[model samples]
Target: MAKVIEVDPEGLRSWIGSAKRTLTIESEAMARLIQALDGPLGRAFGEAIRLIKQGSGRVIMTGMGKSGHIARKIAATLASTGTPSFFVHPAEASHGDLGMIGRDDIIIMISNSGETAELRAVLDYAKRFQVKMIGLTSRADSTLSHHADVALCLPDCREACPIGMAPTTSTMLQLAIGDALALALLEDRGFNAAQFKTFHPGGLLGAALTHVKDFMHKASQLPLVAPTTPMAEALVTMTQKSFGCLGVVDGESGELIGIFTDGDLRRHMSRDLIDLTVSDVMTRTPRTIVSDTLASEALEILNSTKITSLFVVDDKNRPVGLVHVHDLLRHGVQ
Candidate 1:
């Protein structure tokens, strides 16, 4: 058995107040960063983008302490988007990692104060090797900025910490800048979702981008019947295929002319369903999708039309495949 401690209302109120104040301060800092982006900061960003895009080499990100963590994330974002990039520890660069930096590669060095000791070795190496360096720092006059090919000076803003020492607000601004650069490069390179999917497979994103043809039932699995086939035979084909529907194609032209679904069966319950031909019971001009259509798009069709399955056809409207909502759901597509 555990003893329940009495709650302190006053203490809890103070904690909430502190948290709100921290959020307000950080929010204001981000607002200021947005304003700074419209000024000289925007120009510096443009220059960085131009240099990185024009170069054939990758972006080498390096930083110290908290900035190092931010740099690693920025590198990952850049790499996944379109621009190739990787993070190298400043201290590690001094101990043989400098070999990773090629002459064509550009270095993005992050330092809030622009005077990190470990970063000096990387700066010196960049200078010696003639590698382009972009410095992200608050102080424009600091050593890092002095040696940089392009100095992206951060706005003059204090940390959100109560003591004004911790890296709350500054790190937020750094991350915002990094994100801005990555998105800018992504747009400039025309990185479409298909290209992004290649790098982001094996997750919800991969499922969303998966093409219909990838998981759709191919021709052999499709429950297909000639337009002249009896409804009884078509029902058997539909049952055996287990897709709850049968595509009606013209035997002469091999073109899909109609579809017979379970819903159609219900609507014709008053008629002699078994003796009828598929052409008499089927719904003409049924909804269809192409083989290259995305599974997500097919889901949209199923949702909008209030149907469970769709016929996957070719350019000539020949039924090449069939896709069910269950197929999309089973493939982890929503």
Candidate 2:
């Protein structure tokens, strides 16, 4: 048997109080950050964006300790959002990683005090190579701010830590600034979901961003028949295709006009059903989606309409493919 731990009610209350205080402090710090963005920080931010967008080479991120962790996350966000970027440790740069910095590259160096000793080599290298440097520091007059092409000064704020030493609110501000920068660049480049899917292609995010065309059954795989097609033949094709639905097309134009589903089958159930044509029971103007539609949107349509599948249509309203809810599920799309 596992040993049960005793709970201290009073201690628990104290812990909760501490947590709330921390949240309040951090929230206040973030509010100050909003004001900070409207001043010189804002101008430097715009300059950094222009440098990054204009640069032909990748963005190089470097920092030390807690700052390094935040830098890595920022680099990842930028890389995933279409801006090429990578993190290089400041210490490692002094050894040999400085070679990673080139004249065309943009360097974003993060340090709360703007005086992290490990960053000296990276700073000197950027200066020597004429690499554009964007400094993220709380001190406006620090060495980093002086040497950087653009210095984004962080708003002075209290740390959430009880000792007021550990990075808490400051790191949060850094993270928010990094996200803002990445999104600004994303919008500047007109990055879209389809382009985002190219970078994230192996998880729930990837599945959500995936286009309908990727999961759609196309060409011969579509369970299609003409409005004039015999009900018996259409039923056979629907069964053989195993899609539980059949598309009806205009024989002359080859454009989708209606769809035959299980609901229609039950509505027209009778002894003379097989003798009728597909047009006799098919539902007209069926819900459809374009190939560029996201799979996540397709799932929403399936859930909202309480249906299992949808047809992918071209600009001409011709049925190009079919996407089933099962296809979305199998690919990890919610």
Candidate 3:
């Protein structure tokens, strides 16, 4: 790799200015793309959607080079948003990956010039497999678009690169078109946030937005101690449960009367812990949340109060489960 030369601040500023001017040009180009969404493009979009709705198998997206990257992103977006879609590298199609596509699948191929030699194999495979084809290309008259069932003709736009060599504006248009397709499919399928969580459950944003009931320990998992219980046994109860706390319940009614936390244990260190009863040390009516609460609301309580856990209760203040900070952490909560 060649080393970059250090230049004056003003010299760097001029290059940055040129980049900004290029972005303005791209923005204008995107606006023109919307304006160019005339009768033909609308018909193509409608036909593509009809094909997708009628199809039973997945959507197979393929493209060459940078268009391939955009195609892969579109495939991922579609897959995660309830539309069954996957990417097949056009170059690899010639190398036996073409066998992975099925006749029931709809082939969506992308290319800027729409004349990649490698993509030709996938185009051929589409015909051989009897798969319907949709072309996302700038040139409507290009080979890839000519034989397609639907052609999403991109507007002829200048590149955002200073030399007009990079795939900036075209890639953006492809990505925007993919987004439009995905959202249209999402609405058609009636995809909801709950369904979205099923696809994206490995992140803090997913956990934080999830329902508290999903992570709360319930039934036999709950650790409850009667308020009349000795502090000596309550200490063991709180420790064994590993919740750093114990729900102090009514011996007869089984209703949560108080809570004995690790902090509460510390407060009573001055007293003989073994001699004191949970009734004497436990704090009455500790912080609690209903089972119907959202994890986001629980997170707000945890963050603002800097508390590690909350007691899960019923409408009548009966202990149903225990929610811990560790449980949230395990579920990818922030």
Candidate 4:
């Protein structure tokens, strides 16, 4: 337990000033990272990315202490994005987890000093197993750096700790370097949002949110009326479906002729309601989206036109579905 110390504005201000000075060290370290970007280390990173892409098996990242934590995060990010990856602690690997390493796996080991005894043994064993090796570190001259098939060196940066001992800016650069590799691989693989959704399909955030067909009411579910139908009939169909609208189509080929809505009904109140036909009452070929389109697109259509619903159609101009504002909201589509 610690006692609470009395402090005032001046003490707080001095603390703020000290914190502000740390930002300068971080900035200067980031600048030094640019220099390391052009050396053999850069070539090594390119090779590591290539090896992971071309390799038939998964990627295994391992490290000790702060590096181990970073390795775990890097593994997770890579696994989520496009690559299959997992973390192995150097100490744990030394104990028994070494059995998890496979011949076809790409091994990425991270360390600031690159001389942790446990990591060195892991690297040595990995070489015998013929697993491809990638090393990340600040000191290129370290034994771990020398033994790696690919060595990624970080720029020299001052630790923000008062004694200059804690891993601060070093961790940032390590994480950033891993990000660069993962993102570079992602771009090269042409990984898009649609592909990303295949790996993550829960919480209503899947690719289904992006495609309109997943949320739109299809075929018979779509509210529609014949062109010769009365305006009153269109209102009844639209209201029953609760889509705020109805598509008017021809009897033969089901091609869209027009659309009628609550707005159309409001404007035609003075006319003889009984004599009003969809042909005389409907708006011409109202705005619509294709079945394969995104649900967010339906929201866009509604917003841009100041309407609450859109008719979804297929290639032959046949009404396929109806998408309403409520539907997008229900599906969590923004």
Candidate 5:
């Protein structure tokens, strides 16, 4: 049988208090790091960004132990933000992976102590190849910092762990610095959302960034009627298209002029609706979108206006396509 130990309320309270203290310590450490950014550390950050931006090769990040985990994340962030980077295990470099390092590439070595044994081979290879090296370390006098072309020395801060051994606050600072570097590079390169969408084109984010033209109903599928057409005929077009709405266009200019919807039908039900022309009942100046508009934007309009459909128009205001909220939802635009 499993042991059934009695719960201790006082012990639980003490655990909670310890957890809060850890969080408070780490928070204060990060705040000190922010304050340190305006000094020599700030100049070092700027120089690192300049070197990486001017280089014609990718950034090669290498580390060991806990720093290795942070290195992987930093590499991923740099790659996804248009920096072209990848993480390499220092242990792997000793065996044969050192061949992956190019003379043109910039090496970023991460180590809290700046003396991780596994990193020695990679650092030697970088030096021999004459590759530029950037060191992210807390110890400025350590071997990694001594060999690096640029050293981003972290501010002096104790670990959040009560024993002061495990990497707690140090890892947080490393991650933050990595994020800062990636964002700075992204801004310097003027990386736009369109380029970002290109990199992230396989998930909910990709679906959300889809353009309106990709899923909109084209001219053949659009329910359209002339402004002078009888409301009875417009209703037939609406039903045939099965979009619950009809775009009213000018017969001479082929330009969109108004829209007739199910709501309009309900509003005019008490009048001589059948005898009215589309010009008499249709709503003028209906909302519209261009082919280049994002599907997410169209979704926003539909939700904000509580309307079901929008006409996609060309430069001359001619109806070229239609975008229904259902179409957007079907394509996962939301």
Candidate 6:
């Protein structure tokens, strides 16, 4: 077994100092990067966005080594944000993956040094096919910048690593540039949360973005009662629906006017309670939600009001559906 070595207090302090230094270096590099957006780099970035927006084909991202990892992440972000994108490894591109690149597609190639040998095949293929290329590199005089239709040259900055050779600040800048491009495209196209939800429809993020109507109990499943319904009958309806609450609606207009819960039942618990109508025992103007409400927001309402269920109402104030806290929890809203 490996020995459990305890770090000395002085050693721990040095470690913390190193971590802080790395953050400071990377932060400063990011600051320098934003300043370049005012100049040629900004123009190049805009051109890239326009190119992708106008193209019917997908965005192909490629890089070598650590740049490859950043390329994959950027591709995923672009794809999820409404832009069709995918990552192709440069080494693999040389070995037949280059077939994935289409003539109409725009290629965003990442390389801190701008001279990765593995990218040569991809560069040659892009040139041969007249495919537009966007180069992300720190070297303006490099071959990549010379061949690219739009060269987004990163500002010169020091690496966060002590050796100064590892990809630290450069990778951070690359990731940031990728995110900026994706968001710019998203804004240009007016992509909304509904589209985002469509792409991310399986995880906690998907659940949070899910509409209340999608998970709500509609039609016959809602625990609803007329304002004139007696408390004895309303109790049976609530029990049958198993939502722990009842929406009191008007018989003439079919609009929700009140709600009855266990708390209301306890507050009105008397020998005369059975004889009272639901209108008298219910709480008027009860908090409700719309069908378009996000599940996260619905959960927030339920928690803040300390209620387990809410009626999903329409513009007419009619109870169209019902949502329970259990339903939100079941869908991973929390």
TM-score of each: 0.90, 0.94, 0.72, 0.85, 0.91, 0.94
Model 5 backbone overlap count: 0
Candidate 6 local Cα displacement, residue 231, angstroms: 2.0
lDDT of each: 0.91, 0.94, 0.86, 0.83, 0.90, 0.93
> Which residues of candidate 1, in runs, are more than 4 Å off?
1-16
Q: Which stretches of candidate 4 lie over 4 Å from their true place?
A: 1-28, 31-41, 207-210, 264-275, 296-306
Residues 1-334, candidate 2, lDDT per residue (tens digit)? 9999987999999999999999999899889988888998899888999989899999999999999999999999999999999999998998889988888899999999999999999998888879999999999999999999999999999999999989999999999999999999999989999899899888899999999988799999999999999999999999999999999999888899999998889989999999999998999999999999999999999999999989999999999999999999999999
lDDT for position 118 in model 5: 95
Task: Write model 5 residue lDDT over 1-334, tens digit each, in one string.
Answer: 9999987999999999999999999899899889888987888888899889878999999889899999999999999989999999999998999988888999999999999999999988888888999999999899988999889999979999999999999999999999999999999889976788789887677877888888788968989888888877888888999989999888899899999899998988955888989999889998999988887888999999999998999999999988889888887777
Spell out the clash pairs found in candidate 5.
none
Candidate 5 TM-score versus the reference:
0.91
Can you rank all candidates by lDDT, best first? 2, 6, 1, 5, 3, 4
Lowest summed lDDT over 10 consecutive residues: which window, candidate 2? Answer: 94-103
- Runs in model 3 lying further than 4 Å from the true structure: 1-7, 34-40, 201-214, 219-297, 304-309, 313-318
Name the lDDT value of residue 31 in candidate 1: 88
Instruction: Report, for all candidates in order, the number of backbone clashes.
Output: 0, 0, 0, 0, 0, 0
> RMSD of candidate 1 to the true fold?
2.5
- For residues 122-202, write the lDDT of model 1, one tens digit per residue: 999999989999999989899988999888988878887999998988888899899999999999879987888888888
Query: Taking the tens digit of each residue's C-alpha lDDT, what string does model 4 give over 240-306?
Result: 8777778888899998878888888788777587577888878997887887776656777788899
Residues 1-334, candidate 6, lDDT per residue (tens digit)? 9999998999999999999999999999999999999998899999998888878899999999999999999999999999999999999998899999999999999999999999999999999999999999999999999999999999999999899989999999999999999999999889988899999999899999999999899998988889889888888998998888899888899999999998888888999988989988889999998999999999999999999999999999999999999999999998
Pairs in clash, predicted candidate 3: none
Point out the higher-scoring one by lDDT: 1 or 3: 1
TM-score of model 1 (CA atoms) = 0.90
